[model samples]
Target chain A: MICVENISKSFNGRAVLRDVSLEMQEGETLAIIGRSGSGKSVLMKHAIGLLQPDKGRVLVDGIDIGRISYRELRTVRRQFGVLFQGGALFDSMSAFDNVAFPIRTFTDSTEQQVRDRVLRCLDLVNLSDVGTKRPSELSGGMIKRVALARAVALEPRYILYDEPTSGLDPHTSTTINNLIKGLADQLDVTSGER
Target chain B: MAALEQRLIRPLYSLGRYALLLSKGFTSLGHFSVYRKNLIVQCGRVGIDSIPIVALAAAFSGAVTTVQTAYQLVSPFIPPSVIGAVVVPSLILELGAIVTGFILAGRVGARIAAELGTMRVTEQIDALEAMGLNSIGYLIVPRIMAGIIMFPVLYVTAVLVGVGGGLAAAVATDVVSTGEFIRGARENYLVFGPMFGLIKSFVFGFVITSISCYMGYYTEGGAEGVGRSTTQAAVISCVYILLSDLVLALVLL
Candidate 1:
């Protein structure tokens, strides 16, 4: 579970999020609906401890993220999978390697195991055939799908999607929505969408 | 009062941020096993990839220095071998490292800044952090290690190529015979010459890598910001390299 309490954030003394509070329980899909520049992404960043609030605290699994050491914060962060607005794929790596990255980093899986898991994640996102493509070569929709594949590669407890379907075509957006729903049900994962 | 505080505070804030970034690069060194692979890849980037340019620059510098020195020593009493003496020490003690430092300040430093700045703007760095990875350990550490390791190797290469170029130019220009040049170099060669150059290269390596990494990592805005960081990285690396060169010469020599 993630709990944000009275969080306030500002940039250059201009307030973005003020007195915001929320809670997300396990196995739930929560959507933060707001227009662009409405701090939806900022709020999501706070929930994952990516940005600390100027005031108030974030609690992950009952431990206050603001009060913990970085090592402890990383331990908390491991429970999350974030799909950033830009897809945030490593430009140097292929789609397959990008998906395999988290798995290989956190697990002592053999090469074969890593490959199998990466392919499965790609399959889940319907990007099984584009694994060898770099992010630069992929279309916007394909990039988002590959990023989604990478996000769920570790089967994280909570997956955060920031404007995942924004700017995508209606067909692609529906495909993404369905994939998100299917992955949530299949993996039994909590989800937060902005 | 407010304006004055802002004027005084901004540079200090940047300094503090730079120092803190360096501290993070050192402090949060994650698994060495992970670093080993990255370090090797970076070595190839900073070392093996840089040889041609360094060699090219060193050769011209040495040839020019030899020709110029030969021109200046127009006296019956001065042996032609004196050109070798002057050229050898100049290349080994100063030109080799300084030239390489300047070249890399533009080449490697700007490249690091652009790469990291792009990552910053693209949210790739945040993505790495979000994944519970030590982004510093993953990105900066290997680059820094490569810089420190490769700079001196390039310096040695520069010194060797520089001396060879000097000898070649001396013979080709009929300024000094090959044997005379070798004799002069052997006679005037000091144990401290190459040592000082090596030391300078190491310091320059750290300056270029750390400053550029700091500039790149903290970059804000977008494409314009990336261009700004890349330019700053190159400019600042060059400035710091020269400044440190003076300090090292004073302290070490």
Candidate 2:
């Protein structure tokens, strides 16, 4: 479970998040919907320990994220995966390498194991054939799918999706939403609660 | 009154902001290992990768130094051997440090700033932060580390190639015997010359990396902003390196 308490954040003395709070229980999905610049992403960033609040706390599984040491933060970070708004894949690496990046960085997986896991994630996203392509070569939809595959690569207990369907067609958006719902159902992953 | 206040206060505010950013960059170096692999990649890209160009520049500069020095000392009283002594010290002190620094500013510094600036414009840095990664640790540390390590190596390579080219020029022009040139170089008070060059390289590396990273990390706007950052990285790093070289020479040399 994750809980955020009275988070307040300001940039250049202008408040972006003012006394925002939220909570998510195990196996629950939460959608953070708001207008542009309504502090949705700021709230999510605070929850994930990316930004420390001025006068609040974020507790992940009873541990205050702001109070944790950096070494401990790595452990906290490994527990969740975030699909960025624009699919921040490394431009120089192929999709397969991009998917395998986190596993290679944070785990002791062998090359074969990394490859197998990457292929499995790609298959899950129905992007098996596109593994060798760079992000520039992929369509907008394919890039998002690749980003989703990379986000879920670590089998994270929680996944955060920011504007996941912002640029996709209705059909593709439905497909992604269904995929997220299916992944949550099958893997027992928690998402943002509404 | 308002115009005067704006002129003074705004500039002061900018200066203060720059100081704050410099402090932040210094603090960020503590977690450098988080981006160790990336540093190695940048070192390969910036240092080892720019070897051929640095060598070519050094070689030509060395040949030019030999020719100019020999021409100026056309008097028969001053042996042509003195050219090696003059060239080696000058190369190690000024050309070796400043030229190599400028080359790196143009090559690696601009590239890093542009790459990170693009990432900034594209929101990748924000994405990393949102993923619970320290943007400083993930991005800046590796680059600084690579710069520090490779700059000295590049400096030494420059010195060797430059001196070798100068010697070849001396022999080819029949201005000085090979033995005379080598002996003159050996007798010179440059026992600590390479050490001085390395020290300069270290300072140059820090200046180039910090300035370039600062420009890139704080870039705004879009593609034009990125281009501006790249230009700023190259220009600012070169100017800082040169100014610091003078300061270091007064203090250390």
Best by TM-score: 1
| Candidate 1 TM-score versus the reference | 0.98
TM-score, model 1, chain B versus true chain B: 0.97
Worst 10 residues of 1 chain B by lDDT: B21-30
- Tell me the docking grade of candidate 1: high
Clash list (residue pairs), candidate 1: none
DockQ of each: 0.83, 0.37
Candidate 2 regions exceeding 4 Å error are B1-39, B126-135, B171-180
Over 4 Å off, model 1: B1-3
Residue range A43-77, candidate 1, lDDT tens digits: 99998788989999999899999999887888888
lDDT of all the models against the reference?
0.92, 0.83
Q: Name the lDDT value of residue B30 in candidate 2.
A: 43
Worst 10 residues of 2 chain A by lDDT: A69-78
Model 2: DockQ score: 0.37
Instruction: Name the lDDT value of residue B168 in candidate 1.
Output: 90
